[model samples]
Structures are given as C-alpha cells and as structure tokens.
Target: MEGKRLYVGNLTYSVNEAQLRELFSKYGDVVSAKVIEQKGFGFVEMGTSEEAQAAMDALNQTVFEGRTLRIDEARPMQPRREFDRGGYGGGAGRRY
Candidate 1:
C-alpha cells in the first residue's frame, strides 16, 4: 500500500522469519522477513508494493501456524514521547 514493507500480524509465537519468507515467496520475491519474538507478529518486505499487495491479498485471511494472518502496509513508527513526572527524587522509600 504505502510502501513495500508490510506488517504481518496474527501469527503464532512459534512462527519464525524463515517461515515467513517461505510463505511470502509464493507471491513474489521476499526481500526480508523478521519475526518479533514473543510478540506474535512480524514484518515482511516484498520486492515491490505490488508484490506486497499480492501477498496480502492471497494470505491476509489465511491460516498459518494455527492462526489467521493479518497482512497490511507497515505504518511508520511514531516516536515515543517521554513525559516528565514532577521532580520527586526517590521519595522516602520504605518497602511497600
């Protein structure tokens, strides 16, 4: 959609990068694949947006590793904003 990078969700914890590559490769060239450990999700970068779309179209609702896959364009990560908690320097700590 937006770019070649695609966000692959609804994955089982056991799914790995190589599995992703193998699955996506059917639609087109898999540029890269990464499985976020313990997150049950990963990223797959196809050779082009068209490839990504094809993969998404074919595999979005398909079951893999006992779970339905959710494929879509990866969104740019938003920067985390740090909030300032009032300067309370280690208030009298007594094991709660």
Candidate 2:
C-alpha cells in the first residue's frame, strides 16, 4: 500500500498490543502494534510498506480470535472541523 501502517479491525476485546505485534511478526518485522481497548480495532505498523502489504494480503478476511479480521492500509487522519454552535445563520431572525 501507500503506507507502512495498517488498520486492523474486527478484533476481539481481549487482543492486546503484544499479541498483535506477535501476530504480524509472522509476516515481517512489526514496527509497532496497538489494540484500542473496547473499540474492536487497532493499528499495526510494519518496518516497510512491503511488509505491511504482505501482512494485509495474508491476514485480511481471515479468522482471528473468533472473528474475521479486516486489515488494510491505514489512512492518515483528517483535521477535525470546528463544531457549529447554532443553526439558521446563528440567529434565525430572533433577537435576544
């Protein structure tokens, strides 16, 4: 893929960082692994893009921890937009 980071989804609640790292190490050197607790997802980074692709190819749609894993290249986070405080142009023609 375009990046070495991978998005690992459909994870069981019990999976941890060490377990994820170990699971991916089978494909290549795992740079990092983090399982988001209670989120049923995580991120795994490999030493290189090739390694990450290999992991994704081998692991995607496979069963792990009693669930099918969904693996793919992780996308970069976009900046969050500021929340709108009110609707109707902030006034709605009503005066305070």
Candidate 3:
C-alpha cells in the first residue's frame, strides 16, 4: 500500500541483503533486501514512497554484477495455488 517495495530482477545470484541495502542506500533508507535463490530475483522495501521513487529513478539503469538492475514498484502478491488439483493434464482419478 505504501509503494515502498520494489521488484528487482536480473540479479546475480550472489547478491545478498547487505550488499543490496548498501547499493540502494544512496537513494534512501532500504528497509529490506531479499534475493530469492529459487526465483532468481528479489525485492527491496524502502522506508518511504520518496525513497522508492528515488531508487526506481536512479537504479533502474545501473548495472550490477554485469546486469542492469530492473527496479519497479512491487506488484501485489498473487494468491497461492494448490498443486495440480485439476487441469488439462492427467490426475489420479483421470484416464489417458
């Protein structure tokens, strides 16, 4: 709701929380930085909207680990889904 979190993608897997915070701290207070290993992307939450905006403005084109940081306002998380309940593929009760 605060538009404080940013969607950061195309990151090197080695980038960690402290480095991310340090990198973006120039813009403002970085509340949190999470680099998800599984998803190969991460999120950065700032202390305020202005901080978020500054990060987005300054960091979007900056390269890190040989890749440019893609920073944007974080989207609302989608609802989680259960595994393979029923779909086009076969299920336990279905026949091929």
Candidate 4:
C-alpha cells in the first residue's frame, strides 16, 4: 500500500525485481519491487491496500520458478546497533 510493502520469501536466487513486478502486476499496479541481493529475499510495494490484498490473496502460496513464495505484510525495520558497542573494546561497561 501507500506506506507498506510485502515481504516475499523463498524466491529463486536469480529472480530480480522486474520479474517480481511482472508477476505481481497481474493483480494490480506495483509501485516497486526489490530483491535484496545479499539476503535472497525481497519486497514489493503496491499502489493501494486493495492491490496488496489482491496480490496476497492470489500469490501467498503460489509456486514460482520452483519455489513457493511466502508473502506477508512487511514489518518496520529494527533500529540499527553499533557493531562493536558492547564487545571487547568499546562503550560504557568496560571490565576493570
């Protein structure tokens, strides 16, 4: 929808955003589709809640390219943590 995206998982490694968009566009207008190269998962943004709902209804368990896609409402990203914040050499609780 306007402020939300769908989390699509179990996708083929070689599949890209365009392929995702093309597949989902059948349900409605897809605002954007991005496959995170490192994580092997991706997100799809739709124009409206209706479109998102439609996509979910039809594709939640659909098999594509030898994998069944798991689609769900995307959650907000967790806040970032400093990589070395509480480890051996950093930050507030240093051992004596």
Top candidate when judged by lDDT against the true structure: 2
The residue ranges of model 2 lying beyond 4 angstroms of the native Cα positions read 88-96
The ten-residue window of minimal lDDT in model 3 covers 81-90
Q: Model 2 — which ten-residue stretch has the worst lDDT?
A: 83-92
* Cα lDDT computed for each candidate against the true fold: 0.89, 0.92, 0.85, 0.87
Q: Write the per-residue lDDT of candidate 2 for residues 1-96, one digit (tens) a residue.
A: 689999999999999999899999999999889899999999999999999999999999999889999998999989977554565455655577
lDDT of 1 at 46: 95
| Candidate 4 global lDDT | 0.87
lDDT ranking from best candidate downward: 2, 1, 4, 3
| Arranged by TM-score, best first | 2, 1, 3, 4
Question: How does model 2 fare in lDDT?
Answer: 0.92
lDDT of 4 by residue, 1-96 (tens): 445489999888899889999999998899999998867689999888889988988999989989999999888999976667677647557777
For residues 1-96, write the lDDT of model 1, one tens digit per residue. 769999999999988899999999999999999999999899999998999999999999899989999888999999986554443443444334
Instruction: Report backbone clashes per prediction.
Output: 0, 0, 0, 0
lDDT comparison, 1 vs 2, better candidate: 2
Candidate 3: C-alpha RMSD after superposition: 2.7
TM-score-superior candidate, 1 or 4: 1
- The candidate that wins on TM-score is 2
lDDT of 3 at 12: 86
